[model samples]
Target: MIIRHFSSLFIAVLVISVGCEKTDRDRFNPLDPLNTTTGGRPQGLQAVAGHERVLLSWADLAIDAVTSYRLRRQDNGGNETIVDLAERPLSATFIDSTVVNGQTYTYRLSVLIQESEGGVIQESPASVPVEVTPGPNICWIADEGLTQILTMTSDIRAVDRQITSIFGAKHLAVDPRNGAAWTTTQFGGADGAVAVRFSSKGVIDRTVTGFTFPASVVVDPRDGAIWIADIGATVGEESSVSRFNQNGGLLFKITGFSEPSGLAVNPNTGACWVADRGNNTLHLIGDDGTILLNINGPGQPTAVSVDPTTGDAWGINVATQQVFKIRSDGTISLSVSGFIQPVRLACSALDGSCWVVDAGGGQVIRLRASTPDGYHIGQQSDFHLSLTDFFVPVDVSIDQISGQVWIVDRGDGSVVKIAANGSIIRRFVGLALPVALTVDAGPR
Candidate 1:
């Protein structure tokens, strides 16, 4: 009975000892040299371009038992990796070698001490993940009407956001509901591409791989699906149009036109207008991809915009500067002329004016309501970034609330935000070579 009592007491002591044991992992410091002078604060860490390495650094602590710093990385959709710690306070930055491009990587930190800062060692909170990525695969945009002008420049490289795709892209349309941008990549080197949304900042949401190249894109307000004009070739004898859901699911594909270029969705009519530039025609398709009206017109009409107010459609001639009016009967009428290299068009939601981007003349001409319209030159402004400057601009969009205008400079690879006074406020770089800037400011 005495032996049994002794055994019970021994087991209790063993359990107590195991619970009190400390581990090496519980004692390491963060990658940054903790600065107690700043109340043990750390600062000034940077990530270099074109590398997977992240430099972690901090100031040394002023009055605590900080001996070392520990660094760890958290990858939300990938494998977790730990960065080794520094034994002493850092003079330079510590490097983390296990990061990758195009992944959501975040970091956590801790401090190792002599048990004086506290009775035990403790870790710090993790930081919000820093997303590292390379570049976008493709994006779609509306060609704010310039292709109709005979004197228009054929330089596709001016407004092309992808460096690899210089002279082969057209339009840009953004889905304000879904925050996705769709634009047409032209036919030159890589066939054509369409409907690439920015899933995150500077990252494309391309979920499919094997589909043929696409042209223009517009998101359906009814079902949130993306409709694309898949010409497949610039000079093919036949072509088709396709539809994709917001989830990258291939919903539908329809073939009819010889070559499809421009796409416009009418809200009131719930119809999609497609410009058959190859056959010099326009086809109005219902929501279910059924053909409603096939309008034939003058030589190769490129740019088209639907009138929400009247259900009318306007198009630009690739061989001439004439803006044609497309009646429901598919008849064409000349509206304007004397345009220099007119290529793309955007109809405004606020004033209902049509903004034309003439890449050849380096000018953005605005036409207020209807065909046979007069042009109003916007405030010609200089775009400044670092030391360089941009003279001519391509596409433009405005915020309805603040009345601020944003434009993309084909001369420079930058997008600039302009005040109501046409003064440059802020600029964002690294967009390859931006030609168009479209914003989806929600519900306005």
Candidate 2:
């Protein structure tokens, strides 16, 4: 009986000892406390503004303890969204590309801490809210009739702003590097004609002086340098191409051209191709004022354009009614005749196609690359259209992305947008003798 009672007491002691061991383990466990305790909040939260997005960054306080991060965002209208950073737990930066331009946004950050082996999750406090507002996508248009530069949305819905002080604003080009539009004044003093760089808000930032007759302006695609074609006061004397930095400071000038009319720069090669009517030659110039190739033959080359895809240059001769293609190696590859006084040309960067403006015919011609087995080397006319509303189209610009063509009708004082299929999209009227037109690759 005593042995049985001792065995029962030993079993009872064993049971109590095991229970006490379990209780101690639960009370002193390091991982148990971590599962219940939250980590430190994220610090140094910041928001950087972008065209249509906001970039957020933060300093992780308990990076070693955090298993994931949570990003919270709220707009000015009080809409909220929570984003989990499970895939990039340690990433300190996040780009909120879903944001809209011109809208204010607030952001906060927090961290999720979990004990090893999948313990309870604890969330730290959110960081202080950071606010940011993005810049809107805008288009700049030069109006010769109104003698002003108009800022409008990409959809051409409304005129956001206008700079009315600019007189004789014949041609304009946008410098994407600084959101400033450079325009040429046809009439100026003895020193030379003036080109004014105006901000998107219609503020004149700087005036570039000393151009004899600034007829055309283009921005270098490789760099943001400005190139102006100065048609000299005389027939062939002093006609030159001038290069200017983004600040309107003259970089250098290239002389000895008879009459530099149209200008285009190849983004890949940084070569400026000028159509000089005085000498009836296509001058391919380097960034450092080096004449890489001067091909003489196209009768009175009026306008020149560089194909972004193939680096091929195209020039239209209004006198000969012919279009010539210059290869990247500075050789005349092909020439197509039978156009009615093609004055201006714009080539697409997305494709090797081009658009030609025929002032004599009052029409625009669309040219595209021939098929694999076709005879033409560079391009051939796909179709030609004479818009019923156009009287005399002077200049043409193409939106490479959307394949939209913008034509400046000088005779009727209108700017018309046409789709790639020769369909008229929209026409903006009520301008006074619109001479030049350009399209910006807004907010890429």
Candidate 3:
């Protein structure tokens, strides 16, 4: 009986030892780098601001041991969300395109690992949190009749601030980096023609004078230099484009062009594209006032713009009643004929698509360089009526972030906002001859 009892006790001891061994094998080591109680967390996490997106990056743990990752985000309203990677990413970067402007968000990242032997999942402690706040992509409109520059949200909501007494303000440009604006006025200031700069709050910052007829103004997105296409007293004679610092000081002036009626700055390169209507040429002038390339033959190019995404230039030839696109290297890419009068054109910064305002057709047309055979016409609100006396759109601008288009309806004395598909979004009426406008891509 004693022998049997001893054997049973030995067996019980053996069973307990085996169970303890299994528990130790499956248990996580606190000293292990992959341990959830210790290291193995993602480090150096970063968040960058984008138009309507947030870019996140981090230094992940070793790929051999890591199974996936976890991203946690907290919005301003105290709402939290967690995102888990289905599979490990080749790179440690993710783009959150679902964000909106004017909202603040905080983010955290953690490493995920699974034990090979036990098939037990473990999550490392989260990394340090990072915070970022996004935008206020506003639109600045130039009213020739009211002699004012108005600011509004991309959704066509008024910004509650307007720069007054800007007489003959036919064209305007806003610096996205600082929210400052520059415009050309033909009749208000001490000089008959001047390039005026205003602070973000409707206060006149600086007024650069000595221009015969400053037909167009633009701000280089690469550098905050203001450029003015001064079409001198006579067309084609003494016409020049001048560059100025943010403080209204002259940087340099390039002369010897006829009727420099329009100016567009290349966002990548601070260079400017001048449309000389008198000479019927498009001149790509370097930032330092050097003539880079001159492409002849867009018959009387009245207005010009550059697509930030493609670096291509789009111009409207009112004289030829056509719209054309020019490659950055000075070659004519596509020229589409058949318009009563295409007055102004604006290019999408996010895409190479161009929007043209055909005054005679009373239509806003969208052109894509990839598909040269066809164009999309933004449907006006009165499309069903087929009214001949509809609103006459004289100028066009685009919100780079949202891809929405804003048109200046000089005929109806109103401004209209439309989607990229040409459906009317909203309209703001009762303005005095809204001739020109620009959507501010800068952050407020």
Candidate with maximal TM-score: 3
TM-scores for every predicted model: 0.54, 0.65, 0.65
Off by over 4 Å in 3: 1-135, 235-237, 373-390
| lDDT for each residue of candidate 3 in 64-88, tens digit (9 for 90 to 100) | 6567778999999999989887563
Q: Which stretch of 10 consecutive residues in model 2 shows the poorest summed lDDT?
A: 370-379
> RMSD in angstroms, all models?
18.3, 18.5, 17.7
TM-score of model number 3: 0.65
Q: What is the lDDT of residue 14 in candidate 1?
A: 89
Candidate 2 per-residue C-alpha lDDT over 223-291 given as tens digits, one digit per residue, 9 for 90 to 100: 688899888846444888888887778889888887788888887777788888879888888888888
C-alpha lDDT (0 to 100) for residue 362 of candidate 2: 77
Q: Candidate 1 at 87: error in angstroms?
A: 24
Clashes of each: 46, 1, 3
1 versus 2: better lDDT goes to: 2
Q: Candidate 2 regions off by >4 Å?
A: 1-139, 188-192, 235-237, 371-389
The local distance difference test score of model 1 is 0.54
